[model samples]
Target: MKLLILLLAPLFVVLPIYGYQSENLIDFKIKDQFDKVHEKSDFSDKIVVIVGSDREGSKYNDLWVKAILDSLEKNNTGKHVSFIGVADLSAVPFFMRGIVQGFFPSDTTKRILMDWDGEFAETYKFKEEHCNIAIFGKNEKFVSKYPVQKFENKIFEQILNDLRKLFSK
Candidate 1:
């Protein structure tokens, strides 16, 4: 029993325990694909939307982005909302980072932040193999995290309704 406990202790220390904690998001600094540093302070006084995904969940990111963008355009709420994309690259080996980066688009308009160490994902308790959507109101106050296993209209509408309520306030 002692031997088994000793062996498993290291795993517990190394692996991130996933759970949603209701607390304000602490400050963090991370670089985007364009090497632009984005910190919590940068999003002050804005309704920030953070869309994060691992490699498997990445396919659904664009659909969410499009839906959010379309909603913003239709409601003329573009100025109130800020979108940030975070790619969970913790699984990518160090040597493969450059190769993986090469696969990203060259567009300068949108920024795709890289969570190289999975710190952000762990902090947010992101669901594996699913798109994670977190919204923060002004002053870095965490509003909610939408569990998105796959794109669904009902879930999307709920998100939009929450955003609309936030915008109205």
Candidate 2:
């Protein structure tokens, strides 16, 4: 019984983000590195891309975030996609965001922010999950969510395809 209880314990964990609702996705006040405000609704009628990342100082995050951003750039849709760094929202280690940034090119299209406490992560349910990409419609409705690593000829490709679908509607 002890072993069984231990195994089952992990199952009860609750994800930070309950789920995305299209209606609740708009009129946003998300922070930018410039200490400016980005209205979630500005992307209204456009697709909103939100990435929840943990500030782990590893080459893995760099590769993943870069790949994710690169795919967004190729998206034919004119929607705005943002990649929020874990450090910006929470108290992620200083070095971790830098490491992820290093992997990316200077002119990358995706906008990245430091998520220090990961309010965005939990709001988007990124920490308890992997590849927690959420697509909100122009009307601020939740459309779709996909894992970063699963499909796409590559992980990033899959993300782009999802974006196309998001903006196509």
Specify the highest-lDDT model's number: 1
Please identify model 1 stretches exceeding 4 Å from their true place.
1-16, 19-22
Q: Evaluated with TM-score, which candidate comes out highest?
A: 1
The lDDT for every candidate, in the order shown, is 0.83, 0.53
Worst 10 residues of 2 by lDDT: 14-23
Clashes of each: 0, 21
* lDDT of residue 11 for candidate 2: 59
Model 1 lowest lDDT segment of ten: 14-23
Instruction: After the best TM-score superposition of candidate 2, give how far the Cα of residue 70 lies from its true spot, in angstroms.
Output: 5.5
